[model samples]
Target: MKIAMWSGPRNLSTAMMYAFGNRADFAAWDEPFYAAYLKRTGIDHPMRDEIIAQHDADSVSVSAQIAGPVPDGKEHWYMKHMGIHMEDTPLDWAEDCVNVHLIRHPARVIASYAAKRENPSFWDIGFQQQLEIFERFPGPVIDSADIRRDPEGMLRKLCIAIGLEFDPAMLSWQAGPRDFDGVWAAHWYGSVHKSTGFAGAEGALPELQDEAAKLVAQAMPFYAKLAESKLA
Candidate 1:
């Protein structure tokens, strides 16, 4: 099975990827369309040039690569994708995959993202794009907060919802980068690379001020649209 796990940046996405990648039966891909997205939009992200040079810069090739094989001969594939990365790519490749949506509270997303990249725009967080994909694929959605609060419990529920068996290996993983990490890992994956498992439950919603607050207001509706169907 090809599991297309869609999420936004700073939303515990890398940790979830690690959880699934830890499973012996699954092979994982990290942000397959990142390079293509960068190349297409010419966005000045950190390591932009390096990422395009190191990875497939063509969305067509990347799409075929993902849809063609279960890498390493694994029984399942877990692909961690950011919705914003789908900007210029077609959804045709995802047709056969078990498309699942991953979400986080907009306030939490904004707070974490702003720390890494200052003044992140609404589009940068990918909430609206995530909702667009949810509408097209119409599959299960899982919240990062729910997963952090009870990793195994929520993951087990996630597995059941997606017609897969729960694997204990999804609970933790070795710290540090994996072979499949995107070249931009050095820029975006610092916190996740150091994590061995999902962090503990988050505290009260952060009180956002100024622009950050407005950004959250823009994202909350999209986030709430998907959160309604997230695995409880």
Candidate 2:
């Protein structure tokens, strides 16, 4: 089985990768198109130069690779992807995978994202692009907030929904970077790397102001549309 999890940054993406990676039968991959996106867009992300230099910047090759095989001869492959990273690259690869959209409330997303990179544009957070991906390859949707509220229940439901046996290993994992982390892990994966399991239920949604508030407002509609189908 190949699972393609479509998501935006500052969501629970990394932790979810770790969860699936911890499962003995699954091999997890961090964003496959990150380097390609950075190369194509020339966005000045935190470690753009290093990310492009270290990871493959060839979108065609990247696309073919993800479509090709589940590496290490694992029973399943779990790929974490950022919707904003996709462009003209073909999405035909998604047809073979159980595609899932993982979403977070924009207010929470905006607050977390702003702390790392200031003054983000609407596109940076990925709500609109994710909706586009969902519209095309419609599948199950999961909310980070709901997962935080009940990791075990939600994970069990997700596994069943996909016709995969539930693995208790998904509920916890060793804390630290995996050998497969993207080159940009240093800048982005700190908190998740330190976590042994899902953090407790999140607190109240953060209050945003000015640019952050405006960006959240712009993202809310898309987030809501996607959230409408999230696993309850």
Candidate 3:
């Protein structure tokens, strides 16, 4: 099965990628559209010029690389993508794959992102935009909180959606470094690699400033809308 995993920034998308990539039968590709999006929109992404300088904003080439055939006859392939990527022009590559949308509480997500000195960008906004995106897509959408709360159950549901039987093997994966992960792994997910199970608490990251908190509060309606949609 070809599966595309979509999520917002700092929403455990990378760690989830690690879990799926751990499977010997799965091949994973990380954040391939970002360079292209940055270039095409001419938006100021955090690593803007750096990424464009390296990849030259060639999304077609990047899309090709992302959709390239897999090796070892892996039955499943996964690609990690950010939700903000869905725009006026959708990727033709995602047309036939099973899509899994991962969403998190905006308060926690934005707070976590701000703690890391990360900019929220337009992608961080909750509600109408995000809700519309989720509702338009026909696929399984998993709440990040639920995934963390019940990894096993959620994984089974995910497997079922893609026409695969639940493999107890996916419940837990051995943690380690592997190729196919983005270079940002070392910086963003260092603590995740060392964890054996879910890291219960949202660690002691810096608190969001009042201004940021207010902004997140304003986005709560959208978050609530998403929570409702996922439950529905």
Candidate 4:
């Protein structure tokens, strides 16, 4: 089985990737289309040049690769994807995979993203884009908060939804990096590298500036729509 677990940044996506990576039957991929997104938008993200040079920048090639066979003949393939990465890419290719949407509250997402990018907008947080993909290709939606609150329960539900057996190995992993991590891991994966499993819930919601708050407000409806369908 091939699973496309789509999520926005700062949404426990890396932790989820770690969970799946710990499974012996699964081959995990981290943001396979990130380089293509950077190439298409010319966004000056950290390690931009190296990222673009390191990964395939053609959307068609990337999509084909994502739908291709599992690496090393693993039984399951778990792909960690950013919804915004599909901004200009085609979606039909992904229909073959079991898609899972991971969501987080907009206010928390905005605050967390701002710390990294300083000026995150709706697109940066990916709520609208996530909604679009969810609509185009309906799938299971899991909230980051829900996962953090009950890691095992949520993961079990996710596994059942995707027709995979739940493995206790998904609960913890060695604290470090893996060979499959993207080159950009140095910049974005510090917290995840230090984590062995899903961390506890964060503190109170962060206070956002007026502009950032407005962006969150704009994203809340979409988040709400998806949240309504999230696993209990």
Candidate 5:
């Protein structure tokens, strides 16, 4: 199975990938389009410069290499992507694959985005764009927060959406990174690499500034409505 999960940053997206990669039979890839997008656009991402400074590789090139070929093993392949990354890529690349759209509350997302020194997110921009894409997609969609809350139930539902039966293996994963997750781990995720299972913790992120709070509130209605409609 070729499964693609699209999500925003700081939304436990990396953790989710870790869960899926635990399946011994599955191969996964993390955020392949990032490097190619940066290479083609000459636009720098928030962490692009810093990450490149250390890794000395473009994220797009690395994503492509990781995504390039699936090994002979694994019945299922999962791809974890940031929804905002879809802005410039070909939609058909995901054709014939299950598109799992993941979302998080704008308030929390904004808070997370702000905590990172680089790349103040274009939250409104990214959110609105993803909302439109979700509306257009004909496949199954889901909320990341909901998945964390009910791993087994949600995995079953996700399997059903893609015409597969639930496998007990989806519920939990062994600690550490898998081959499919290498590109992402090497780049964007350090904390996730050390995790043994779902982080499972949910709460307010760092306190938001009044200005950031208001910005998130303004975008909340749109995200809430979108999630309500898709998840309903």
Candidate 6:
């Protein structure tokens, strides 16, 4: 089976990727369309040149790669994708794979993202794009907070939802990067690369600035709708 776990920035996506990568039966992919997104949007992200040079920049080719075979003939493929990356890309191909939505509270996402990119907009945070994908191809939605609070419990529910047996290996992984990491890992994966397992729940949410507060307000409704369908 091919499973696509869709998430926005600052979510537990990398940790989830590590979980699936630990499974012997699964071949994991990290943001396969990132280069394509950067190329299409000409966004001046860190490592922009290298990322475009290292991976296929065409959305069509990247989509084909995702729909293609699991590497090394693995029994299953687990791909970690950013919802915003699919903004200009087609979605029909995704129908062939099991799509999983990974969400985080907008406040948390905005805070974390703002630390890296100043003055982030709704598009950068990806809540709207995530909602669009969920509407187009509905699937299981798992909150990052839920997984962090109870990794095994939530992951078991997720596995059952996706028709896969929950493996204990999903609980932790060796700290550091893996082959499946995208070329932009240097820019975005610092904390994740140091993590051996999901971090515990954070303390009180940080206060958002006026602009960010407005963005969060805009995202909350979409988040609430998806959260309603999240795994218990």
What would the per-residue lDDT of candidate 5 be over residues 17-100, giving only the tens digit for each residue? 776776777777777666555555667565565434444245445545444566557677788766665665656556656777
User: Candidate 6: misplaced stretches above 4 Å?
Assistant: none
Q: Candidate 5 overall Cα lDDT vs. reference?
A: 0.65
| Candidate 4, superposed: residue stretches over 4 Å from native | none
As for TM-score, the candidate ahead, 1 or 6, is 1
Those runs of model 5 whose alpha carbons end farther than 4 Å from true positions after fitting are 46-70, 123-125, 182-187, 204-207, 230-232
Candidate lDDT (C-alpha), each: 0.91, 0.92, 0.68, 0.89, 0.65, 0.90
Q: Pick the candidate with the highest lDDT.
A: 2
Candidate 3 TM-score over all chains jointly = 0.81
Give me the overall lDDT of model 4: 0.89
Tell how far residue 175 is off in model 1, in angstroms: 1.4
* Predicted candidate 4 versus true structure: per-residue lDDT over 5-121, tens digit per residue: 988888899889889989999999889899999999998898999999998888899888876888988999989999989887888877899999999998898887777777886
Candidate 3 positional error at 22, Å = 1.3
lDDT per residue for candidate 2 within 1-232, as digits (tens), equals: 9999999988999999999999999998889899999899888999899999999999899889988878999999999999999977789988988998899999988888888998888999999999999999999999998899999999998998889999999999888999889988999899998999999899988988887888888999999999889899
Q: Tell me each candidate's TM-score.
A: 0.98, 0.98, 0.81, 0.97, 0.79, 0.97
| Candidate 2 accuracy as lDDT | 0.92
For each candidate, how many residue pairs have backbone atoms clashing (under 3 Å)? 0, 0, 1, 0, 4, 0
RMSD of each: 0.8, 0.7, 3.2, 1.1, 3.8, 1.0
Models sorted by TM-score, best on top: 2, 1, 6, 4, 3, 5
Summarize candidate 1's per-residue lDDT along 152-196 as a digit string, tens digits: 999999999899999999998888999878888898888888888
